[model samples]
Target: MLNFSATVNQTDLRLAIIECGRIAYERHLMTSNDGNISVRMENGQVLITPSGVSKGRLQANDMLVVDLDGRVVSSRPDRKPSSETPMHLEVYKAREDVRAVVHAHPIFATTLTVAGLEFPVDMLPEVLLTLGDVPITEYATPSSHEDAEVIRPFLKTHNAMLLRQHGSLTYGKNLDEALIHLERIEHVSEIFWRAKMLGEVKLVPPEAQAKLLAIRDAYFKR
Candidate 1:
């Protein structure tokens, strides 16, 4: 039921996936083999990071292709699809517009969930305008079908989410946008955490927030 994008050179997409992983690792969005990245192909298959490989050092050939059903379509003989494939597949199944997904254990974002601290997203205009509200999914065992189920309700309304006591999930029309969403989550979390330590943090005025949401809605419409 998903409408795939136009044809894109698979090799280039593989390289893009590699770059996303490296940047994420370098930025500390994820550490070691802590995260997964996937990009949907025009043919409806997905290019994803291989299991057990350090994302920072991923090679183009290390990527695997899998159908929406989470079966491997193409991959090196020695490679396996990410263990989190079910989570990625659910994303594509539930949202056709999502072309890429980035799941990472960002320190601040994950810490927010671990500490059970609420993120006042409306306090930041950039967050309100770009990401709206990022909801936290109930705790689900990692890499399981439950992971998919827990995030299902949030898919329709949010492009970014916090996994209870785990990490974050973000997706967009492309990998860059998805990565940016992950970054925004960590950035906003760190800011809110720091502000809470400094003292009580004031929210954006309600009237201004309404205006920002209007702009956000108009932008998303295009």
Candidate 2:
């Protein structure tokens, strides 16, 4: 699998952000001007999606470089960092291991958030192995400090979460993993929704859950 970690230059990082946006759009995870993505660079700077643009339509030059304090560090005519810049910055500040952050509003994940369904646990080996628990942040005004604060507690334990009534957030050691986790949440939500329609969702037993988690730990190490 091609991953952004193959990158070693500034150009590669910029293009990776564009790829993240395109992948989100292709998967129907974003539309219009609805999503945000960011990368914390090796130099300790940040590259983020500009405000008020479609993620699908983003070009390499559309990215903005900012400092830890959200000050623009690069030149741009009209583009500023994403309004959700605070949210991305907070994740990076809180999770030292997270290098990339992605926020998108995929159908099933957002539907589950809007309908108040918590992310499932032990219902499927894949869900448990991929994400132990997808936390749901309390609803707060979007693009505000209040929204950022709601997710503060989950950063250490989760790689993905549903942002109450707004969208979903996923972060990782690299852009590919971050984007994959976002997609994984949506896929898991869809699977559970369909299974519920068939009957009550079948959950994996505790013993089986432990074994699957062990396997997941080994797999993640690779």
Candidate 3:
């Protein structure tokens, strides 16, 4: 059986996930039960959304608790873990810094992945500083270990990535940071599509890009 002491702030974390779900839904980032979210609790248990449930309607009780090894330690008796749990587990396994993982199918980002177009790193400074180069992992069947393995390499250097024909996965030191990365990816994808409509795209100079990264690093360190 899984073992851990329940933390006091779980209610707050669950509410945060619920609020994020509503925002993602209202923005049309996820439809029906299309996305999943997970937050690491103080006790090493992960609080995650249940499978097949509409994210917009989730309540605090809808969260499930599982250990790092993916063993269920606690949950509402009726709720099951998200189908994408393994992907979240793989991320936690690969990066000690990540405390939350979000999987969403925002229209613009998913559309680019569906069309096999990569987000141009040279087009946006925010994307460079916040997300780095968002790589596309090779296609793998969803809810499978194969899917997690394909993204393992990029997870170390990137906070966000497109899952080939699937959707997008983003991680961070906490839930809010991860959500910010997802929001930025969606915005950048939108800009890329708009630029395509106007004419040929323009890119930031390589030297400028390096400066942007340096500035971001310095800001974060301080």
Q: Which residue pairs come into collision in candidate 1?
A: none
Cα TM-score per model: 0.95, 0.94, 0.92
Candidate 3 structure quality by residue, lDDT tens digits, 28-106: 7788889999988877779999999999899989999999888988988889999899899989888877778889989
Model 2, 28-137: lDDT tens per residue? 99988899989988887889999999999898888999888889999479888899998999898888787899999899888988888888867878877887888899
- Native-to-model Cα distance after best TM-score fit, residue 121 in candidate 2, in Å: 2.6
Over 4 Å off, model 3: 1-8
> Following a full C-alpha superposition, what root-mean-square deviation does model 3 have from the true structure?
4.1
Rank candidates, lDDT, best first.
1, 2, 3
Model 1 TM-score (2 dp):
0.95
Top lDDT prediction, candidate number: 1
TM-score of 2: 0.94
Q: Give the Å error, residue 210, model 1.
A: 0.8
Worst 10 residues of 1 by lDDT: 1-10
**Model 2 steric clash pairs:** none
